[model samples]
Target: MTPPMRLRRRVRFVFELARAVWWLTRIELGLRRNDLPALCAKLGIECDLRSAAPPATEYVVLPRRTRTTVLACAYAVARWPMGSTCLRRCLVLGRLLRSLEPVLRIGVRRDGELSVHSWLEIGGRTLDATSANYATLGSP
Candidate 1:
């Protein structure tokens, strides 16, 4: 790519990262003080906490470049002193990829002790690791 083009792309990426961080902060605060539905509403995502299946409405898949940027931002935030949890990451990702109709899933597993995990799914495919092992509790 040309030098100017590369610079422009980098600038856009940084902007997106900042936006993702802002949304993450909002989501974290919302989770601490409000209920799930309220948080979803604030983020402009229609979530059905009772539903397990992905939304029936069709959605266009997010472009690979955008998906990579979103995931990178999530990872960056997760490395902070106040690290992001699985639920938080999924919530943020769901909000970021709302146009793609991401499904936020919570699941549990019995591995000597019970453990809960959360992940996001798009087009019926799980977006992160560890979800395959957990029995789904529900999706939002």
Candidate 2:
């Protein structure tokens, strides 16, 4: 018999949480120290790491369930004791949406305080919870 919707959602939540934890652990242990390209290679994901070009204006609509799963994964990963960085968040999100060819982006802002941030974009449109102020670095 089919499970109830609430039970299905809960199961999805748990799966997403486990997926997030696995990716976060792999990234932290295997890929965190490498440069952008190397990290992408190790993860078998593509991204933009350059700082040229304006943000893409096109947006793609992901299924509600997929979006929900990605959000849950992000939340779970970020809640870790040390907390997650933008790179970790984006990587986990990208892994979930790998078929979508999400472009992982690292941007920098150097106003008074220089800072770098990583985010994911799909079909040229930036994903939710991404910063708009940071300048685009590159993609793959």
Candidate 3:
């Protein structure tokens, strides 16, 4: 059987998915960088909140690639106010992004109300440059 610590690590990783979804939904929603990054910052915090206890040892819990959790955490901080609509979308899209890393883009209809917007990219440019239309601020 997996050790207790290993079990905690695995569980933490699963919830990490939830944290990622929440943040990504916010980012894809086009909520400004500072606010969104703030949310993403909470991914680790939120992950711990979701857990019964932290691991016996540091697990180095992280996504497979660079700044994945950071981006996700930033997203959560920015869009947590949007509630479950954004969250639901985040889960779906975050899963897609995980598989399509460096090549994922998820955009939504952007109305004046706080909305969710997502786009995928590689290196620096957009993998799919489609506009989420959260506001008229950004061109599709």
Question: Of the candidates shown, which would achieve the greatest TM-score relative to the real structure?
Answer: 2
Candidates ranked, most accurate by TM-score first: 2, 1, 3
Q: Candidate 3 on 83-136: residue-level lDDT in tens?
A: 634333433343434543332223335356565454433333432233323222
Off by over 4 Å in 1: 46-48, 52-62, 138-140
Candidate 1 displacement at residue 53 in angstroms: 5.7
Each model's C-alpha lDDT?
Answer: 0.71, 0.74, 0.41
Q: After superposition, how far is residue 121 of candidate 1 from its true place, in Å?
A: 1.5
- Per-candidate count of clashing residue pairs (backbone under 3 Å): 0, 11, 17
lDDT of 1 by residue, 16-116 (tens): 77777887778878989999878877776655556665333333356876765676567656764567687777777788778777766667778899998
Residue 132 shift from truth in candidate 2, angstroms: 2.8
Cα-based lDDT at residue 78, candidate 3: 53
lDDT tens digits, residue span 46-72, model 2: 877665776654555787859667778
**lDDT for model 3:** 0.41
Query: Positional deviation of 68 in candidate 3, in angstroms?
Result: 10
Residue 80 of model 1 has an lDDT of 46
Give the poorly placed runs of model 3, Cα more than 4 Å off: 31-140
